[model samples]
Target: LNLVDLRLTGTIPPALGKLSQLRRLALHINALSGTLPPELSGLSQLEYINIYDNKISGTIPSELGALSQLKELGLDHNALSGSVPKELNKLNKLQLSACELGGT
Candidate 1:
């Protein structure tokens, strides 16, 4: 499926984590807010995930690093607070914004 430019609210459903064949997930510019479900890590085939400009608040889940194939992760301008997931260091392609992380 070709899904883009979707404005979804509430926590990201754990069900979405089941898309084993998903390649890209873009849900930017929305009111979606909550901790990222570790279940999302199941999407091993994901290459991109755009959930920027939202109300989502919580520590960046270390599980995100499981997207070994991920090329881009957009999570800027949100209420999220916490140390940047150290696991993220494993990603070869990451473009996180300042607002999502900072020195304590």
Candidate 2:
């Protein structure tokens, strides 16, 4: 529940997926818009997720690969589109860095 860059707006409150021992969730550079709440893949002790520079759009939520202890996934900038959910490559401790979609 780090709530980084607290310019937060709205959306993303799917009850925080019931916080199943939530590990790290930094709402980066906020003004949070819509999409990206696949029940947060039920958390499952999420490792790190920084919703970078917000204005969130759609796609990229293939149930977040069910988290399986996600390493790092910061969706860079925003206005996300499609094509990125090959089940997140099964997360093998994913290191997606800054997932740039539209812009900053």
Candidate 3:
């Protein structure tokens, strides 16, 4: 599912985790806020997640590391804090530039 630059607002719905077959998720350049729901780990087939340049905050969920198929994760330009979860090293591409990661 792609909803890039749609001017979307509010938080990303946790119910979206039910989309078991979803492969890619792009919701970048919007007004989306709130923490990423760990429920998203249920997307076993997910490969990429691009939610960049938004108002999202909080730490990257360790649960996301469970996505063994995930290759790219674009979450830059947000208000995220804390160090990246070590469990995410398996990803081939992880983008978190411009995030408030406390020098980690």
Candidate 4:
């Protein structure tokens, strides 16, 4: 689903995780907040995820590495912490801010 630049607010609905065949998710340039749902690991077919430029926080879920099909991840300009899970080394593209580089 592509919800980019829609000015969306509030937290991402965790139920979205149930879309097991989802290939791409775009929720960028919004006001959405809160941590990314670890449940999203259920999206086994997910190839791209772009939740950039939002108010989301928390560490990048290690569970996301289970998205073996994930090739692109756009997570810059938010409030995330922690070192990116080594499992994400499989990604083809990754976006992150300087703060994220210095995070715990």
Reference-based lDDT, each prediction: 0.78, 0.79, 0.95, 0.91
Off by over 4 Å in 2: 1-3, 6-22, 30-44, 47-52, 55-66, 69-77, 84-104
Candidate 4 runs further than 4 Å off: 98-104
Q: How much lDDT does candidate 4 score?
A: 0.91
Where's the lowest-lDDT run of ten residues in candidate 1?
A: 1-10
On TM-score, the leading prediction is: 3
1-104, model 3: which lDDT tens digit per residue? 99999999999999999998999999999999999999999999999999999999999999999999999999999999988999899989999999998634
TM-score of each: 0.84, 0.29, 0.97, 0.93
Which residues of candidate 1, in runs, are more than 4 Å off? 1-6, 98-100
TM-score quality measure for candidate 3: 0.97
The CA lDDT at 75 in model 2 is 80
Tens digits of lDDT, candidate 2, 11-100 = 999889889998999898889999888998888998888887888887777888877788778787787776677767755444333444
- Candidate 1: the clashing residue pairs are none
**Which candidate tops lDDT?**
3
Ranking by TM-score: 3, 4, 1, 2
Clashing residue pairs in candidate 4 are none
RMSD of each: 2.2, 11.1, 0.9, 1.5
lDDT of 3 at 69: 93
